[model samples]
Target: MSSVTSSSVSLPQGFIPVMLTPFLESGEVDYDGLKALTDLYLEAGAAGLFANCLSSEMYELSAEERLKVTKTVVAHTAGRVPVVATGTFGGPVVEQAQFVKRIYDTGVQAVIVITGLLAEEDDSDEIFIRRTKELISLTEDIPLGFYECPVPYKRLISSEVLAELLPSNRIIYHKDTCLDIEEVVRRIQVAEGYRFGLYDAYMVNAVASLNAGAAGLSCIQGNIYPELIVWICENYNNVERQEEVKLLQKFFVDSMDIVHSAYPIIAKYCLQKRGFPISTYTRREVGELTGNLQERADQLLEDVDRIQTELGIASVFRKTLEVPLK
Candidate 1:
């Protein structure tokens, strides 16, 4: 493993948006569109950017494309916020470690290893521990994080595994999708005394998770209205905003299907409507968006506009590209 100072990098907190990989209408990776998207996230107050995640269509992207995209995002962000990119994708440990090294060389703060990639279905925690330990041993000095990726299968990490890993401080960030507030609290408690962060992907429990000491949010909602997520993070504890927070959380829960049912497709469409120069093309095999879905997405955007206006936060949506197309 390459040697680097992992301890010097603080794990990011706040709305670290799981970014979507923008594509041109012809289905090529839209490098220019991606630069705009990066700027859009930063302008909307994202504390960090999560590239090559599930939302970024990692399974569909070639390894070379993944590295290229990660490098583009890191160069554009220019150290304004930390970047975490997925480094493993269910392959041999050696191959996974080599990819980690390559991704770390992109100047990302940390490499996220999907927990599902460590072992097969029905594998015991002992196997998981053994494999993860070996991988860690091989990739020493490179900061690592865990993501409970839902694709292939969503393998929620057991407390035993967390207990074993957190103390070592090698795993500094966890993108948790367990969706249970109590479980999230338990995970946070397990990492208590360690320099780790748990970013909840379940938008419904974002505020509660933050209240329970979760590090921040890693959700698709951030792609559409990151400022709203940032607002909840900023004021989740304010006595005056209690009712307002509840209402916002309710909106997230109710609009889950409208905003995320189709995922990067709907997210890309939402971005296009917002004036981002990207197509709604997704690498997923999912077919084109139906008229009904398009109508629902439009309504969702309108609803979000109204909510932002009512909250006096419409100014956050202002889009000005800091990185011009080359």
Candidate 2:
């Protein structure tokens, strides 16, 4: 087991990509493909990696596969950047706590619990608080985080819950998808005295979030254009580049439909075009990429290429042929 203490560990504060799991045409986890994917994210200068996330098709993966995949990412990263994995979804609090312990054993910096898993749809704040507190108590010493996974149902936390939990210093990371700038600002204010980091997944409001003291971004857009995402985070505060950043943000908003309509399939296709050793096969029922979708992806790539050329960023796509991981 790793001797590093979880509480002392601080997650990197930049573009942490919610990675997609690679699958072979035969519908098996492609280890080599996964290694290459990890390398690609690192090469794009990702601050950290979020594995076994919704983008990774975690619901379809068996418990063993989730553990194996998380371990593989930790092994490949080799301490270059911290890795956080989704450790629990729907289960009894004890079972979920046990799962968190198992994931912690894999050497991840933090384990994320999907917010919807903590209580039933009609449960009150008191129930949610009790369950969360119990899970934290059960998984002592392991750093815990929360993801508002929109699947099943999106249970966004209330400010009252944040006020209750932040003081305990147990929840160190939160992937906020609320998309309300005012609410994000309010939460940041409420969390001022705590050590927790808030990462906004809503790209449309990412710059504003960072401006309002969000620690960083965790988004699927990073899966296709990690370098560009990193560039935004690195330059969002530059006075001279404020206009340019706003324009870039506008571009992202305008192009969201083209890139996100097909989701992981389109994301995989982007990777395939970028020379990763993976297929566009997804466990989700999203059908094959039709010609129209392919054309849209191509157009998006063209826009990306133009932006890269203008910004002097060497394209991450098809630029390197070797899959560095053996």
Candidate 3:
């Protein structure tokens, strides 16, 4: 196998925040906010950062905006840590590959792809088989991570089909948001020797996934409580570690209560509360999150601060999740 193929599936320990795109009153990308947020996460010990993604509202941004975000993030990060950007917009395969090429040229370390983006909702195994091959062909040589997000709007690739498509070492890892833990384990086990990994996006399943052989995690909860993630990764199965992980998990669930299911809205709100220059405003065309979600989100942050202080850890601590920050 090639070095990229044989390389360990494990990423550096801790949270890999899927960054939020701070916006202005006119709904333009807030460059200053983006820079400040990046600095804050790096200081708070995020394992890595992913830009132009679901959290960053890549689906709403134009291709030009996507490229701009990638450029700004890479430039600000310098060489401090690994950075990945979303590829495969809700567009044609070839057009998506063009977007991939554009960002790869910007020097991002990896590309995270959504398998298919079609008007009709269906995913034949052949789509992944052929599309991944085409992506590999077009990118020349950029590492790829499949974002196995739930596609309620479209067809989903089965775990069996995903396992079968692992021959392409370009698909090195997966950010699995599938709520089915058993299914994820079965799929990764099937692809054992192919250098694939699973990053648990659901905070509740994170410890279980790690115990089940996930190489790392890319959690949203990490945006607020990264130290717990780092501690779990560094000391899995230790007795003290169990207490810490349990506390962290409870903290995460409690935090979720404030937002309920308005995840993006709540996440951005918390980021702003942490002194990151993010606006609570989202594109109105995308629709608003119902309920007084932001109020609950604020309460969650207040609770987190109370917990962090009770534990005597700094409200936020720093660790290097990537190397050679520029």
Question: What is the clash count of model 1?
Answer: 0
The C-alpha TM-scores of every prediction are 0.95, 0.95, 0.84
Candidate 1 per-residue lDDT over residues 1-326, each given as its tens digit: 22456666557678888999988767889998899789988888888999999999999999999999999999999989999999998788988998998999998989999999999879988888888888888887788989999888888886668998775568888999998898888989988888788999999898999999998999989887787898888888999989889989999998887776677788877776765666777889755677899999889888888888878785444446322222
Worst 10 residues of 3 by lDDT: 317-326
Clashing pairs in 2: none
Expressed as tens digits, the lDDT of each residue in 88-155 for candidate 3 is 77666678788777877666777788754533455556766776677678766667777755442534
Task: Estimate, for each residue in 195-301, the C-alpha lDDT of model 2 and write its tens digit.
Answer: 67889998999899999998899988988888889988888899988877887898788887877777899998877776665787789986678999998888888
- Which scores better on TM-score, 2 or 3? 2
Question: Which model, 1 or 3, shows the larger TM-score?
Answer: 1
CA lDDT scores, all candidates in order: 0.85, 0.85, 0.68
C-alpha RMSD in Å of predicted model 3 compared with the true structure: 5.2
Model 2: residues with Cα > 4 Å off, grouped in runs: 320-326
TM-score of 2: 0.95
